[model samples]
Target: MAHNQLDLLRQRRFLPYFFVQALGAFNDNVFRQAIIGLLGYLAVSPQDKTLYTNLAPAIFILPYFLFSATAGQIAEKLEKSKLIRITTAMEIAIMSMAAVGFVTQNMVVLLIALFATGLQSTLFGPVKYSILPSVLKPEELTGGNGLVEMGTSISILIGMIFGGLIFAVAGAQGPWVAGVAVILLAITGNLVSRAIPRVEAGAPDLRINWNPIPESLAIIRLARKQPAVRNSILGVSWFWFVGTVLTSNLPTYAEVNLGGTPTLYVFALALFSIGTGAGSMLCEKLSARTVEIGLVPLGAFGMSAFMIDLYFARSGAATAAGLTVAGFMQQPGSWRIVMDLVGIGLFAGFFVVPLFALIQSRTPRSELSRVIAGMNIQNSGFIVLAAVLGIALQRYLHWSIPQVFLALAIANVIVAIYIFTIVPEFLMRFLSWVLVRGLYRLKLHGIEKNVPDEGAALIVCNHVSYMDALILAASIPRPVRFVMYYKIFNIPVMSWIFRTAKAIPIAGAKEDPELMRRAFEEIDAALAEGEIVGIFPEGALTKDGEIAPFKSGVERILERRPVPVVPMALRNMWTSMWSRRDGRLRRMRVPRRFRAHVDVAAAEPLDGASVDAQTLEAKVRELRGDAA
Candidate 1:
């Protein structure tokens, strides 16, 4: 059954981990903000304040660069639950030290504590993500990631708000109050971490690498070997890069361009965060509870569009001073700016959730944590580079911040084109989404419980149209290897999509024995690896919109390697423009149907040894009924 994203919050495995991570994020930001606020309260020199403020973010992110590789190794080598508990304990200790620094006003202790907190966060990063797949079902992964992203965003906001408010109200004793609060939060996090179920080590026998630089490079190399994992890492890192540029400039942008005060800054941040939370929650609905990469392209488009609009919205505006939040809200064109920020964030959620889910779902369990760690390292690198690029563009190139927004927006287009081109699977999936959801309304019957969520199963469906495979491909959440006639597989524009999807192209034994042999061999290999394989028993598109006679190929394949066989039927597709009812070539001359209704019925899996091509064909024919 499909459950709401919020439903996971009630489960023990997910809820405990969620709060622990949320509190940890909350504490990190609170402590960091408390330090900066303390500096301001002390009336520190502007030069010194600037130096420390600049150094704070760098110090915090440095651990991701210095320790992420090692973190991955440790996470893979140790039980994740225990590791998380240990890391949470470390957080408590670090916060205790920070509390001392806060009370004594000791800069050294505070900075050291800050670095320690960063290191602690680095250690926790791998375990946090790697444990999810172990705890949740595959169908729950998208929802799980959505909740995590939403939690983190909201936590950052709350941390900032409370950290500033608490420090100000406490006055001279503010640090002491902040210190105790953080330590308590850390302790609470540790207590929650104890409730997380133990997950076995991913790579228990792997050797640990002590060195950072070479190990980090090696980890990245290992992740780069898988094209999907590598591209997802790039996409995720680019998100952080763009996000850092936009967020880091908000304070100055609000003051100089919009003439807003601190409250307006908070309002803008809230809009972005709220938009992200809303968008993340919407991913499951948009994807029908699947990890849909199609949303990524859609998100990238929205992010770029809103960013470009933001550039125009603020462009050529007169500078204003002492604008309160209420005053800014009352100004002309304020709503446009607000909408642009929110829309950018909303699309950002759409863009990011799927990439994270893809990384989690696609990467091998043994290497998932390491890949995520490499992603963290790259994310940090991109964030730092964004800072540098922003500085250079502003100082050397003399480009305004809004102009930089324009430049980044343009860069996003190039990045999207390059990514989509390099891995056409993303674009192919987007097209499949369009064809299945936009061009036709798909209704699935008995698919939820009938189709196994994991493991190898053979799906046998009656072929009614050339688009049968594409429809099934988009409809099924798990990636499938389709077995299709070689000629159809080689269809001009679709050949690229077929190849990208790793569709197996087969020929009849009499026509081309070699291709048939290879196709069966590929099918066996795919099923052996626990992948789903789909085949049409009729071996051709229907000529009269009727079920064709069953062939012996299915029986022969099952004899070689037995696996459960699922029977499916596609109804109401024979009259579609892509169908062969009017003759394949003649159908192409007909106008394409839009918003056609298609029903896909999948029955329970039959024992492979008991089922043959004839029985499966009858089952599918019955499932199809008189719909055609």
Candidate 2:
């Protein structure tokens, strides 16, 4: 259990895998960019260069479409570390051919090798993501994913630079340099793969499907088994789509809009890539080491904001041509453009990492490899569509680069809204996160130790403030179906959040027996379905800054369900902004202890059949101590 993501890099479990994937990404980009550099080395016509540039991506992506299903099956059937070694070995063979293509300056050889590289990548894709869940705990998923994304992004940027520079820097020796570099990278990745510890097969007893089409469709169905997982896959594919459009337009965008040479295109890309890496690194800290999908909405809108700003920052051609990156920076509005590029990249990171973690954590381990495979296939489709759509917008519609960007920004908003609407959990979590983080600095004690990671359990916490549910929801890694009073459940805008979170609304027997019965039924059903149900037991927000007597509802539920009961206490929340200490229930008041230090403490699970309300209340009191 490494507390920090970087700490994983210091350990054998993660470092080897990280470098293996990073090296693969580096070599992949290096090989592709080297082919582009070859256009100059071979002195091809501009038309030929354009044709090669357009054809390379399609050639590379074709294998993902063709072999992802078979690849997924192979990944599931073999042990993870062994599969990785095999992929790295495949990479060495593929890169060896690519080296010949470079040395002989043969375009056809390079294209065939490029397709081989894609096939190798397609095979690696499932194991690349699926292995993470096996090696990392649920708490470590976000950080681990962040590190992977960071490594891949930075590696891609550096590889692009290194690959593109071989001809420019080495002059007559460019071919040899390109040839040697890719092979060495492949060898390095292979060496790193050897160090990744042995991991059990995702489905060791499973038989692989040799026919790709049926298996591909079957995996796609598997990927869509759960709505959240399905949408997560869609979200990842959408990320690729956005990235494809953005990256494809950068060359022209740089030359036409910024009036810069080829160097500026790389510079702009560097800014975006660096920003993405930085954002990826931040996910662990922002998410509190949880697979927090709340960041997805934050990332989504943040990307759109910067993209829209980018369009406004530069909507027309540059005043001059052939300006260097330095000269381009000297121009007015350049810094804004720089910030926009970085911002879009930063938010894009925020958007994608959580979704990946969600897909990994939520999907069952046995099927995860194939799920990842299905996602890769869909991602390839989205990338191809994005390239084609972007090209169509430019060539057929004659849209300027800025206009294309503007359309992308608008499209992003629509897509985001649609996804969030269909899967309100992403948005629900986002709103809860924002409300909790905005109001308090939370400290958790015994939560990881006491709370069950899976299966049904009743979470009994003290009713301290209006924000208690949000705080607890944000603090706990798993989703909890909070049981609240009908009034609070219908609290204007707060009602929507509660309903979306699937919080059960109850009333006192005297107030409405029907609602109370319905609430009990829902709670029983939820627990029966292996879901966490949270209840205050005191049945209302505490009017005084003291714990109230526990009600009999807890006893009744446990009597019926006989599930484990987790006693949790919200400490120091009595004095917080949303508490009733202001002499009213959620009254508007002047700031007092804003961003207050609030503690959520939990005790080990009590046997539901044995524990009484008074015992649970006393346990919660001990956890809370005198903090209230």
Candidate 3:
């Protein structure tokens, strides 16, 4: 069954990225189409094609390599919320410039407009990536990246189609509609960007270096110092490499290699981008919102494998390589290429999404812009290199287009092996991933009734054993803050889990007075801010089949905060996971009810202003009431 990745796309935070990108895409298409149409119109008229058509792309792309170094430095040096706004404002200016060209009917001015748009995009490159680490969690990184990429490709497709239709239909009056459309979309993009939250730049104090070549190299060097970060950036760069090669040549490939009309180019690009969008959203679902680095190699494997198959699908056909959209659909041999191309696009989703999450999770927040800048540099380098490779292999090497594609496919495989070997995190995750396949089927009873719908509630649960926190964390959709013992908080691998969950650590008053005070302070602060905070009152491990005495500590907490207390009982813990023989040995096996029932019983708000400790203890005991 096909998974629905679109669920993640519905998030309010993601909407801005989607709208902003789509509008930007629409504008890009409007501009490109204006130029392309003008050239095509000139083909029949007196104007020369070489002057306008050849110059547009070069003018646009030159800014990325030229200004990316400075842009990266600026993104790192300023607050990201402001930088994104500035970039979008730049878009407004760029679009306005294009509007002038369209109104004045000057090709030279329009060419300059394309250059301004590229410059805006270049400045945005580092800011876009760096901001994600600040806004999203580690697990969300890959899915977010995927969505951004998918949205971008889809926008490109829409833009191209829109641009052509508008130009072909508008005649000499084309620029007015196109210009107005670009300005409106750019304005919309700017508005959406204004909603983006502030993100701290990684290197606020790092000195700006104006020289693009040297600064770009230095950013690259700084990025490599972090191993995992460097690899994740490489992963993204390679994606751009593959993507640019495909996007740049697909139209040419359809026209020259496949003997197809211009319409098929639209079909091919749109389908591929749609496939990527689907894949990006699916990453969160596939990885369960964790850093599933393992999928990196898996995606690479499929990408390479499918590209080779696409090559095979196209090779045996003797018919026209490119066909009109209608003509291509009618041919049997061409359908194989179409299906193969779709598959290639679909697999791209799987391959690229996780890398985004990895970068966010692994890189230092302060150096994120520098790291992202390094990534952009690599991406630009790869784009140029891939274009060169694709064109050179086709023209100089005398290789068929399909054969050159085959070389790229094989290269993906080789790169996959090299990357996985260098970073075992990807491979190691696949091993543990098998356990996740066991499937967690939930059975709920009185969960909604027992758990408070709103208001601050201090949950007092009997911490029976393993995964107590994980179960509670997963069960409630609303975020919860758990006040855990410092000992448990410092547990070797669990620290990261605790950190991500935003767990607060508490120590016994005698053991550490300062920490205990901090915990209480945190409790009051959380409740005052109208957030949910939980506490487990049973101070120590339940060694035998008996409830430990309720700690007076909870009473003290309630006295100060005066919030409701939710009493929770975890079913079947002592029988399976209690530490009986010191800390080294285990007790009974995990309960047969591994999916045992849990009841979060919310009693009334405590009588904090007047109640004695004994009264509060009695209230807690009544709530427990033989539940476990």
Candidate 4:
């Protein structure tokens, strides 16, 4: 039975870590919001309040610039479970100091405490993300990230509400309550951290570098060495940039453009956060539990579309007094504005979850923590850049917050185009995802366990239709190099996709001997490089919806390279649009089937030398059963 993502919360391996991270996030928000609330309602002068409020976010973010590199090294060098416990212990101490600051009502002490908390968060960032891959299965990466993001979003919202409500109702006693709450939360986080199963240090012998500047540069350079990882980091950072701009501008946007009160502002925040939480959960269902970057582009598109809609939804007239949340919702065109905010948040979830999973899945395990630290450094830079740009456009250029949003939407389009063009894999995956998901209902059996996660393996499947390679490619999680007949490989639209996927094209020896020789050479080199090379051993599509005679090519390939061969069978595709059931012309004339049920089954791998083409064909036939 397949367990839902929420079921992970009950398991010991994941639950403890989840609680620790969630409590930490909750504490951070509670303390930060309490401080902001204090400045807003209790400060002596408007000037003083403005100064502190302006400086607060900067103080918290500064540590990322100073300590992220060192933090990354520490996470890589130490066992994650021990490091988390230590970090949580430090959090308890920091919250104790914050409690003192709250009781004393000293701005200096409180600011210092806030800075200390930021440092604690900076140290925890790398471990929080890097440990997921270590603790969860590869198939669970997307679901796990969704759960984490949802938890964080909900924590932030709850903390914000608690901080504001406690301060409002308690008066002078508010800070005391706030202080005690955070302290208790911290202690609880530490207690939970103790239960986390110990994860082995990824790079125990790695030397620590105390110098932040040079080490930061080196870590980024290391991340950039892998193109996909580098692009994913950029995508993740860009999300932060856009998100910061939207969030930081919300209070003023609500006040000036929407004519909304504090309650309305909170309502707007809730919409965005809830939308993000919903979208994060939706990722597992949309991507079919795989880490699909195709959704990233889809997310980017929705983000820009709704952001533009939000810009247009802005009312030009300003009000001296803001409307209450209830009053604002009742106004004409207000629901559209709210929906736009929700849409942006929803798509933001789709954009970020997959990118994070991609980074975790692609980076070398030993360096994953450091790479995440590098990403944090870049994220901080982008956030700072966002603040600067937002200020310049609104203050210096005399642009309204709505105009800034418009500019941001445009910026998202440019960034998406640039990244997709540079890394065509993202676009290729999007096309493949659309083809498989839109056209067919796919079912898989034993593909995840039977196909080796790492090392060279030749995948041999019985071909039933022209879309066979695509169906197989989309069904399996890993990238595959398909060796298909040259005619089908060069099909007008799909040829580009095959080329982008780096599929190997070949012809029969009688037709093109050179191509056949080159194909064998390419297969040998691909297998040597520990890649998954897929081939249809029957050599061509079945004309009468039946398996063809096995060919000697499989035996020849095995003679050169003795690797495990995974046998896969595709069923229910023989009657599909791409199949040559009636004739090529007639099949093309027939309307394509939508959501046709297709089953793909893979038997356990067999040793290359022991399994002949005939035996492998029989196994595939058995897996297919009576299905044509």
Report the Cα RMSD per candidate.
2.5, 1.8, 8.8, 1.8
Query: Which residue pairs in candidate 1 collide?
Result: none
Query: Model 1 residue 545 lDDT?
Result: 89
Instruction: After superposing candidate 4 on the true structure, give the runs of residues whose Cα lies further than 4 Å from its correct spot.
Output: 318-321, 584-586, 589-593
**Whole-model lDDT per candidate:** 0.88, 0.92, 0.70, 0.88
Best of the two (1, 2) by TM-score: 2
Q: Write the per-residue lDDT of candidate 3 for residues 1-628, one digit (tens) a residue.
A: 1122354466555566556766776678778877777666545444467556546777877887788778888998998888878888889999899889877777788888889888888888777777776665443565667777777777777788888887688877777887887888888889998876556667788789888889878888988887777887788888888877777777767776667788888887877777777777676666655556656776787778778887887753336754678877787667677766776777777777777766766666777777777777777778778877877887888787677778888888888777777876565454323322232322333334445544677766666654556545544323468889898888766665665556889999889999999998998898786666877777766666456777888778877887766555555334443333134454345445453444444455554456544565566566557654
State the lDDT at 273 in candidate 2.
99
Tens-place lDDT per residue, model 2, 398-492, is 99999999999999999999999999999988988888888788888877777887799999999988888988888787778999999899999
Candidate 1 minimal-lDDT segment of 10 residues: 584-593
**What TM-score number comes out for model 2?**
0.96
Going through the candidates in the order shown, the clash numbers are 0, 0, 8, 0
Better of 1 and 4 by TM-score: 4
Question: Residue 61's C-alpha lDDT in candidate 4?
Answer: 94
For model 1, what is the error of residue 565's alpha carbon versus the real structure, in angstroms, after optimal superposition? Answer: 2.0
Report the CA-based lDDT of candidate 1 relative to the real structure: 0.88
Q: For model 4, how does the per-residue alpha-carbon lDDT over 159-235 read when each residue is reduced to its tens digit?
A: 88777777888888888898899899999999999999989988999999999999999998987878888999999
Q: What's the distance in Å from true for residue 46, model 2?
A: 1.8
How many clashes (backbone atoms < 3 Å, residues ≥3 apart in a chain or on different chains) does model 1 have? 0
TM-score versus the correct structure, for each prediction: 0.94, 0.96, 0.70, 0.96
